[model samples]
Target: MNEFKKTNIENPVVVIGGGASGMIAAWRAASLGVPTLLIEKNKKLGIKILISGGGKCNITHDGNIEDLLKSFQKNEALFLKPSVYKFNNRSILKLLEERGVETYTRDDGKIFPKSNDASDVIAALEWYLRNAGVEIRTDCSVQEIIFENNCVTGVKLNNEIIYSSNVILATGGVSYPQTGTTGDGFRFIEKTGHTIVPLRPALAPIKLSNKFPYGWGGVAIRDAELICLVNNRKTHSERGDFLFTHEGISGPTVLELSKYAAMELANNKVELILDTQPDKDATMLDSEIQQLIGLHPNKQIGNIAGLFLPNRLVNHFLNSINIDPEKECRKLIKEERKQLVKLIKEMFIGTIDTIDITKGEVSAGGISLKEVDPKTMQSRLVKGLYFCGEVLDIAGRIGGYNLQAAYSTGFTAGESAAINYKSQSTTP
Candidate 1:
C-alpha cells in the first residue's frame, strides 16, 4: 500500500463529480501529497463507468497518440494533443493494471477489463482513491462554484460551502441524466464567465420519419455505408454495421454520424442513403445480377437476391420498388433489373425526425475548447479552476476514445492543480 504524506496546505483540492474523470483527478491530486476531496451527486462513484460499453466498460482505445487523435475533429484533436500525449491509453492501462484491473483490446481496438465486468473497473478506481487518501462524499450536490476575484475559492453545496485551494469541475455533460450528468458543470461554468457552445446529442440513435418495414426491427446490415444527404446532396457518410430499430437506426455507423444528422435535420431535410453493396458499383452489381439470372433462370428473383442480403430486407426492398418477389429471374425485365441495382447501390431510407439527447452516448458542445488551456485543463478566464471530461466541447467517436479523453484530461488537471497548490503554499 502506498502511503500519503501529510501536507502543510490548509485547503484541499476539491473535485466535482465522481465519474471516470473526477475519480482519476481526485486520486492523482491526493497521490501528489495534496489533500483532495471528491464529491458525487449520485449514491456511488463511477455510475456511468459501470454502464459504459454495455456494462463492460470501454477503458480506452488501443493505438498510438497520432492514430487515436484522428478519431476526433481537427480542432478537437489539436486541443487534446497535449494532455493525451502526456497521459495516454498506455498510461491509463498501466495505472489500472497496477491496481489489479487487467484489460484486453478488442479487434476494433477497444480496451476493456479482462473479466468483462465494469464493476471491476469501478472497484479498482475506488480502491486507488481510498489508498491515495482521497475523501469522497456521495449524495451531495453542488449548487454553485464560489469564486472571488475570478479565482476559485470553493464549491457551494446545498447545506454548506466546502473550501478548496483548487477546484476541478469534472461534472460531465447532460447525457445520461439518470447517471447524474445533468449539465451542472455547464451552468456553474457559465456563471463564471465562460462561453458554452450549444449542447446537443452526439453519438445517439437517429429517429427516422419512415418507420422500419414491419418486422424489420433488430435486423442489422454488416459492412454497409450510410450516407447523409441534404437537399439531395451527400454531406457526410460512414461505413460500419447498423441495426434497424422500430423508430430508426442505431449502431456504430448511425451513432457516429448522428451528430451531423441532427444538425442537418434542424435546418434542412436529412435523408439516409444506405449502400448495402458498397464494394460494387452500379454497373458491376447490374452485371452480376444479369449473370445470376442467366445461371438460375427458373429461380425466383427473391431467392436469387437472398444470397446478397437478408431475406426479410430483400423482400422489403422489392415491395418498395413495386417488384414482385414471386417473379422468376427469367421474367425480370431490364428496367426491373436496373431498379434492383440502384436499390442495392443506394437505397434512400428517408428523412431523420430527431436525435434523442437523453439516449446519446455522449453530449457534445459543452464549455468551448478555446475557453480552457489544453495543456493544464485550467480555465483561461479563471485562476485555479479546471474543466475536464465531457463537460468540455471534446467528444470522440465510438470505441473507447471518449474514455481516453476523460482519463488524459483528468490526469493533467489534477497534476497541474497539485503543482499550483504546492507552489502557492510554499511561498512566503
Candidate 2:
C-alpha cells in the first residue's frame, strides 16, 4: 500500500456517480494525496460496471493509441487523444493487474478479466478506492451542484450541503436506466449553465416496421453487410454478423448503423438492403448458379439454391422471385436465375420502425464538448467543476472503446482536480 500525503485542506475533492468513470476518478484523486469522496445514488457502487459486456466487463481494447483513436468520430477522437494517450489501455490493464485482476484480450481486441467475472473488476476498483483513502457514500442522490458566481463550491445531498472547492461529475448518460443511468448528470450540468446536445440512441438495435413477418426469428447471417438507404440513396452501411429477432434485425452490424437508421427514419423513406454474399457480384453469382444447374440437371431448383443459401431460406427466396422450387434445375428460366442473383446480391429487408434510446448501449449526446476543456475535463465556464465519462458528448463504436474513454477521461479529471486543489491550498 502506498502512503497518502498529509494535507490540511478543509473540503475534499468530491466525485459524483460510482460507475466506471467516478470510481476511477475518485481513486485517482485520493491516490494523489488529496482527500476524496465518492458519491453514488445506487445502493452500491459500480452497478453499471457489473453489467458491462454482459457481466464479463470489457475493461478496454487492445491496440496502439492511434488505431484506437480512429474507432471514434473525428471530433471525439481529437478531444480524447490527450487523455487516452496519458492513461490508455495498457495503463488501465496494468492497474487492474496490480489489484490482482488478470485480464485477456479477445481476437477482436476487447479486453476482459481472465476470471470472466465482472464482479472481480468491481472488486478491484472498490479496493483501489478504499486503499487510496477515499471516503465513499452509496445510496445518496446529489440533488444539486452548489456553485457561487460560476464557480463550484460543492454538491447538495438531500437538505445538507457538502462543501468542496473541486467537484467531478461522472454521472454517466441516460442509457440502461435499470443500471442507474438516467440522465441525472445532464440536469445537474444544465442548471450550472452548460449547453446540452440533444440526446440520441447510439449502438442501438433496429426495430423493423414489418416486424419479422417471414417468421425468420433467431436466424443468423454471417459476413453480411447491412446498408441503410433513405429516399433511395445510401446513407450508411456496416459489415458484420446480423441476426433476425422477434421484432426486428439486430447484431453487430445493425447496432453499428442503428444511429444513422434512427436519424434517417425520422423524416424519410428508410430501407435496409442486406448483402448476404457480399463477395459475389450479380454476374459471378449467376455464373455459379449456371454451373450448379449443369452439374445437377435432375435436381429441384430449391435444392440447387440450397447449395448457395441456407436451407431455411431456399424456399422463400425462390418463391419471392416467382420461381417454382419444385421445378427441375434443367427447366429453370434465365430471367428467374437473374432474379435469384439479384436478390442474393442485394436483398431488401424492411424499413426501420424505431430506435429507442432507452434500449441503446450508449446515449450519443450530453454536455456539449465546446464548454468543457478536453485537456483537463474541467468546465471552462465554471471553475472547480469538471465532467467526464458518458456525461460528455462522446460515444464510440461497439467493442471496448466506450469503457476506455470513461477510464481515460476519469483519470484526467481526477488528477487535474487533485493538482488544482493542492495548488490552491499552498497559495498565500
Candidate 3:
C-alpha cells in the first residue's frame, strides 16, 4: 500500500454502498493510502455480487474496449472510457485470479470462477478491502448528504454524522431491492441539488397477453428470435434462450430487449413475435411442412407440430390456426396452410404489460451524464462529489458490462478524488 501521505487521513474519503462499484472505489482509494470508510446498508458488501450470473458470478465479458463501450448507453459511454479502459475486465479478472479465485470463460465469453460460484467473487472483494485497510460499516443507511457551501462535508446516517473530505456515491440504482439497491442514492443526489433522469425497468421479463401464460410455464425456446413491434413497426429484437414463466417469457434474449419492449408497450399494444426458425425461408418452411403432412397424413396435426415446438404448445398451435387438435395433417386446407406459414414466420405473442422495475437486473436512468466530468467522474455541480456504478446513467446490456462499468468508474473516481482532495488541501 502506498503510504497514504495525503495527511487528510483523519477525515477519510467516504464511499456509500459497498456493492460492486462501492467495493472497488473503497478498495482502490484505501489501497492508495487514503483513509477510506465504506458504508453498506446490507449486513455485508457485494450481496448482489454473490448472486450475479445465477451464483456463478459473471465477472466480465471477454470483449475489447470498442465492443464493450458500444454496449452501454451512448451518452454515458463518453464518460466511461477514461475509467473502464484504465482498469478494465482483464485487470479485475487478473486481480481475482491472483487471490486464488480462478476463473473460466463460458461459451459466450462471459468470465466466471472455475468453481462457478458467486460467493468466491464476494470473498475476493472482501479480502481485498481488509488487506487494503478500508474500514467497512454495515447495516448503515445514508440518510442524506451533508454539504457546506456547495462542497460535500460528509453523510448523515441514522442518529450520528460521519464527516469526510471527498465523497463517492456508489449506492447503485433501485433495482434488486432485496440486494440493497434502495435508490436512496438518487434521492440523496436530488437533495444535494442534482438532476436524476427518469428511471425505467431494463433487463427484465416482458409480461405476456396470453392471459393463460401459466399454461406455457416451464417451456423453453432455444435459438428462437423475439421481435418487439409497436404500432406495426418492428422496434427491437433478440435471439437466444427464452423461458416461459407463470407471468411471461424471460432469459438472456428477452431481458436484453425488455427495456425497448417496455418503452413501446407503455404507449400502445406491443406485439412480441417469436420466430421458431428465422433462418428458414417461407417457401422452405412450407416445403418442409408439406413433407411432414404427406408423411403423416393420418397423424393429428397437433402431434405433428409437437416435433417442432414445446409439447405444451401442440394444441395451442392448432387452435391458433383455427384447426382442431384431432384434425388430420392432411385436413389442413391450402389457405390454412398459407396462414399457418405466415403465423410460423411471424408467430405473434401479445405483450400485455411489462415486469416491475423491482425485478430488473438494472434500472436505466440516473444522474444525467451531462452533469458529470467524463475524465474524472467528479460531479460538476458539486466539486468534490463523485458518482459511479448504476447510480450514473450508464446501465449496459446483459453480460458483464455493468460490473465492468462499476470497476472502471470506481477506479477513476478513487484516483481522481484522491488527487483532488490532496490538491485542495495544499492550497491552504
Candidate 4:
C-alpha cells in the first residue's frame, strides 16, 4: 500500500460532497475513527435529498444485492453488485435507524423515512456524521484538485489550497442544478487527468411532442409498459407510470428508459408506444370490443369505448380511425372499429426529445466501469485514488436504487481507503 505522506492537516479524510454518497462516505470513515471532513457547495446539504421522491426521499430499496443489481442496466448494475453485497440496503437501514431515522418499506420495496418526510432522512444522516466527528464545510466550492505522481494530494477551494493526504471525491451528478449539482465535479475530473465518458442524462424525464391532458398529470400507469420504437421497431420497454409534465412524460418508465430513449433518438426521431394493456393480446381486446359492439348495436361506439379507457382517449382513438362518434355501433366499418381498438390497446406517440444529461438523476457515462475495481470502487488506472457514487459510470433506475448504489459504493470506498491508509501508515 502506498502511503500519502500526511501533512499537518487535522482531518485525515476529506470528502468533497455532502450529498447522499459523500455524507455516507464521511460518516463511515469517521465512524472508523478516521478524522474526516465533508464539503458542500450548497448553503445546506441534502437539499436534493429532501426534494427526492417528492420530499419523501426514497432512502433505499428493499431486497438483497442480487435484486438490487437487476434494477440497473448495462455494466453499471453488474459493477455495483460486489460493493452492494458488502454494504447493501440492510446495513444502510440499520445505520439510519440507529441514528433515529425510523424507516419502513413500501409494498414495492421502496424504503423511506417512517414519517415519509425526506427532512428526517437528511437529519439522520447529518446527525450521524456530526456524532462521528466528521467536519463539515457548507457553501464552499472546490476550484480545482491538487495531485502529484498520479495520486490526489488536496483540493483548491475559494483560491485557498487546503491539503489532505487522502481525498474522496463524492460530488454528485449534474442534475437538479438548483440543488447545487452544477457539474462542477466534471471540471475536477478533467483536471485530475481522468477520462470522462460522454456525459448524458440518465434517469431523467423525456420530452414528448404530443400534448397530453393535464388531468392525467398525476395519473400513473402501473403495470403499463412503455415501448420505445425506432423506425417502427421496438427498441426498449419498461413497465411503470409516466408522470405527465406540462411538457412530457417522466417518472419511472421515462427515467428507466431515458438512456435508451436518448440513444434511439440520437438520430433524431423515435416513437413511444404506450401499451396500456401489455398483457392482454390484440385478440383479447378484439373479443371485448366484439362483445361491447354486440351489446351496443344501436349505441354510438364512442360511448362504449370508455369501458376500456378514459372518455377522452376513447374519442381520440375513434377519431384516428375516422369512426364517427354519432354513428351507431352496427354502422361502424368492421376494419375501422378494429383499428380503433388496436390503437386503444397500443397507443403510439412520437417523441420530441430526451431530457438533458445535466438534468439526469445520476449520470450514466463516467470514468467507465472497466477502469475501476468493483470490489473496492477504486480506479484501476490510479494507484491509491478511488471513486464512488454518480461520478463513476454507474447509474441505476429510479426508486431509490441509484442512491443505494451511491451509499454502497461510498461505503466500500471508505473502508478500502481507510484500510489502505492504515497499511501505508504501518509500512516502514
Best by lDDT: 1
For candidate 2, lDDT tens digit of each residue in 238-330? 998988877678899998998777777778888998888888877888898999999999999998777666677778888888888899999
lDDT of 1 by residue, 1-428 (tens): 43423334446689999998998888899999999989999999999999999999999998899999999999999999999998899998988899889999889899999999999989988999999999899999988888889999888777676777699999998888999999999888767789999888899988888877658888888988999999999999999997888766787889988888887777898899988888998898989999999999999999877766667788878988988998999999999999888887788877888888889999889998998999899998999999889999988999999989998899999998998899888899
Predicted model with the maximum TM-score: 1
TM-score of each: 0.94, 0.93, 0.90, 0.91
Candidate 2 weakest ten by summed lDDT: 1-10
lDDT of each: 0.89, 0.88, 0.83, 0.78
The deviation in Å at residue 338 for candidate 2 is 2.1
The candidate with the higher lDDT, 3 or 4, is: 3
lDDT of 4 at 424: 67
Q: Write down the RMSD of all candidates, one decimal each.
A: 4.5, 4.7, 4.6, 3.7
Candidate 2 clashes between residue pairs 3 or more apart in a chain or in different chains: none
Q: Write the per-residue lDDT of candidate 3 for residues 60-122, one digit (tens) a residue.
A: 989788788888766777778878879988899988988999988888878888999999888
What C-alpha lDDT does candidate 4 achieve relative to the native structure? 0.78
Off by over 4 Å in 4: 1-11, 191-193, 213-222, 243-246
Using lDDT as the yardstick, the better of models 2 and 4 is: 2
